[model samples]
Target: MGANPRGCLRACSLAVRSCLRSFIDEAGVPPAFIVGLSGGADSLALALTVIDVASRAGIEVVTLTVDHGLRTGSAHEARRVADLAASLGARALVETVRVDGRGGPEASARDARLAALRFLALREGAPVLLGHTMDDQAETVLLRLARGSGPSSLRAIAPIRRDEDGVTWLRPLLGLRRADTAGACAQAALTPVEDPTNAIDGPWRAADGSALRRSAVRHSVIPALASALGVDPVPALARTAALCAADDDALSEWASGLLAVSCEASPAAGEGSLALVVSEVSGAPRAVRARALREVASRAGIRLLSGVHVDALDDLIVAWRGQGPIPLPGGRATRVGRGTQARILFEARSPEPTRDGG
Candidate 1:
């Protein structure tokens, strides 16, 4: 906290603007950015910070509050957030999204939100901004750990990145704790509504949060870790994620370079896929080989490539005896070849012809 609310707000604003300026300097300034407002303290603080910074920089920006229709009061919250943006002389709108029953309610809601934001960003030719703080990063890492995810799972909440839709996503508050956002909101005299789902009172989990699976991890698991550690563990967990992200980034770069030299666009019956040269992949280090295979899967829009899939691809190159297609997500797979002339192709399986019941 600061001596007063204004001082605290100013400090928070500085933290955010500094990060944004550095990101723009490195990644090249986009035409503008669209901030996602949820009426929560984090997002309210972000909306304020972004408007102030963009105003100073003379950048045209907009705010969007996605109403997922998952809860009763969501529309009201969106309206409030929009009004806040308007008060600051910024353009804001509420984008309603239909949550499809996929994965679960929580996952579905997330997908819907991302889809809405990405749609807006692409339509406006600008990047999307989020207000994910260090606490969110910690919760994600903990959830991934519980799920037995790999190093990639540990790379939680990237500070900034471009998604598959070619829309850039920025999270300027990841370096700040969740408390800082609340402080920022307080400083700016912004009383954002408390999201009941995020409230964790004592050891008893809120009944309302049951539908949001992440709340379990955020409320229970994270607090348990902090209690056992005898101090707050969020910053530590976030730092670990940062380190993992750096390693993942380096490996991805290496794999990208390898793909340029050792892979080719497969002429396989078109899903627009890639092929890895057997000789090249077989000779490369395991790390480079595994990452290259993942890059191949990602390019084919198969992001659910598991370690088993990667290992199966490895077997194709090192222990090939003409294995059948190793299954991947999105109806895609990797098929092995016999020799140095063979190209391990990442291809989508053709749909089986349907028989008429008549």
Candidate 2:
């Protein structure tokens, strides 16, 4: 921590300005942008820094605080965040969303929050900024590592990403640590809201009553690992994620080129169906082939393909042995034809009807 609070604040401001400058250089500055402010230390610091940077650039900043309505006092907190943003010379709004408990509370809340943010961004025709720090990236890599995730999953969070809906999400704090944000907030005299869900011993838990995976990782696993190693593991893990991201980008580009040559629309199969020429795909290395397979499935509207699904799909290419159609979540894959004429078809499944007639 810097001895002078103003110096710490200035350092954070410079870091944020650098990130914004990079985006401006690539995409040009938008007339305005939306920042997701949760009133937490990370977001509070980001909002303050962004407000300062944008003010100097004459760019409008709108801070949006989403109230997930999962816990008591959330609405009040949202309002408080908005008030702080207004005081900082930026427009602020509170978006209230209902979490339907799909996929689990954590996942569901995230989906809801993002949905709201995307909606507002689309309406305003602006990009969305978020406050995800290096510590968060470390936790994500650690969690995915325990699950035996692939390169894509282990890449963790990208510093900037454009959603399929044409909304660009920017994370300016990815290079900064969690402690940096907290210190910055203190320097600026901002009192951030403490989220109970982030507590390891908080009420939020899995169905089995264990602590939430991220909270446990943040409070227990990282500390224990640091103690055992006699060094802080966050920067090293975050560096690993950055390296994985670069490798994944290269692999993705290669896979995309292969897909362009091998994949085509299959009108005979069904609407929005895709056909992959087996001869063209089978020649590629398995790593590239797996990526191409996943891309084909994703284009066919299957978003959640596990490693098992990709392996089974790969079988349709190199391990073909007269296997039948493999059923997937939203579609099915089948091998057709023979030799040079062989093609793998992905088609959407028709929805099953309810027992009661419409």
Candidate 3:
């Protein structure tokens, strides 16, 4: 893994082939694969490689480019990706989505993009594929760490995600590097567009440098860490994510059982909302208690919870004295009891509930 570009590209090609084949072997054969392409090097390389391999397995491949329409050339970029995907023997499709302005453009765009991809998977009966690399995983872990996240947040972006519709989204390039993706694309004589958002610095960077957290981590934080530590920190961060993911899985499983016993088993606060016995929560271990609170809030549609939120909710249980209520974002709140009941009621925000979270 030297700085030799061509060698990296060759290694990346082999790695992508292995990961994709393994996914197909484990998940069984799919009628087709819907790859979420962005005209970026990582996705372009993945699309081309999967196209070649899936065709050999008698499986069809289709590429969907999400035109976010956030930037000036975004639609053109999608068109370019669709054209390249078509040239690579994969059917190409394009869709436009309106990104909400909340939670920053990146997060809002991501949620919108995933919604579109999930829709495609359900409607077309195929799993969606993403081209997230190890670098992306590293950045995610770093971001979560900064936010004082728990073990689950440190788990970072998962390699595979299965939605409610039973559609599985795959990230075959999770183990690969960003540099290698570009290298691989170069090797095959395919030109990939450089997404302005992915640019680390210079003119491409936003005037407000901190506007995009991912970009800042990718360009500033990562480079600073590498310079200070005298080594590449991305791989170590990614490895930490893998270890944390396993731990999160175990904790979540245990917490699920604890929640079942502790919860009132009734949606007393309305749909997508539930109540938990205060005594049961107080009697549980801090970790399990935190998890139970996490579970309840997650069910109540709070997706972007941090350790701060978890501790605050736990305080309502273990550290309770006379605190009336604890505040949860998205217009939700938690109170110790209502009327004669000694249980905590978790409520959803607004008329309809948001279906997000673990």
Number of the top-ranking candidate, with TM-score as the measure: 2
lDDT of 2: 0.90
Flag the better candidate by TM-score, 1 or 2. Answer: 2
lDDT of 1 at 110: 80
Looking at model 3, residue 222 earns an lDDT score of 95
lDDT string, candidate 2, 1-358, tens digits = 2333366576677777888898899998787878999999999999999888888789999999999999988899899899999999888999999999988899999999999999989988888889999999999999999999778989999988999899999998899888888988887788999999999988779889999999999999999999999999999999999899888889899999999999999998888999999989898988899999999998987668888898999999999999999888889999999989999999888677888954
Instruction: Tell me the alpha-carbon RMSD of every candidate.
Output: 4.1, 2.7, 5.5
Error of 3 at 266 (Å): 4.9
Candidate 3 Cα misplacement greater than 4 A, ranges:
1-10, 17-27, 70-74, 201-211, 266-275, 278-283, 297-309, 322-358
Q: Using TM-score as the measure, what is the rank order of every candidate, best first?
A: 2, 1, 3
Model 1 poorest ten-residue lDDT run: 202-211
Give lDDT: candidate 3, residue 174: 86
Better candidate number, 1 or 3, judged by TM-score: 1
lDDT of all the models against the reference? 0.78, 0.90, 0.79
Model 3: colliding residue pairs: none
Evaluate residue 275 in candidate 3 and report its C-alpha lDDT on the 0 to 100 scale. 77
Can you write out model 1's per-residue Cα lDDT over 1-358, one digit (the tens) per residue?
2323355577667766887788678777767769988888888888888888887788767899988887788898788889888888678889998988577655777899888888889888888889998899998898888788656779988888887688888888888887889988876778987776565442223245443557777778878888998999998999889889888778778878888888778665475777778787677778888888888777766677777888888898788776788877765565545556777777765555778733
Residue pairs that clash (backbone atoms under 3 angstroms), model 2: none
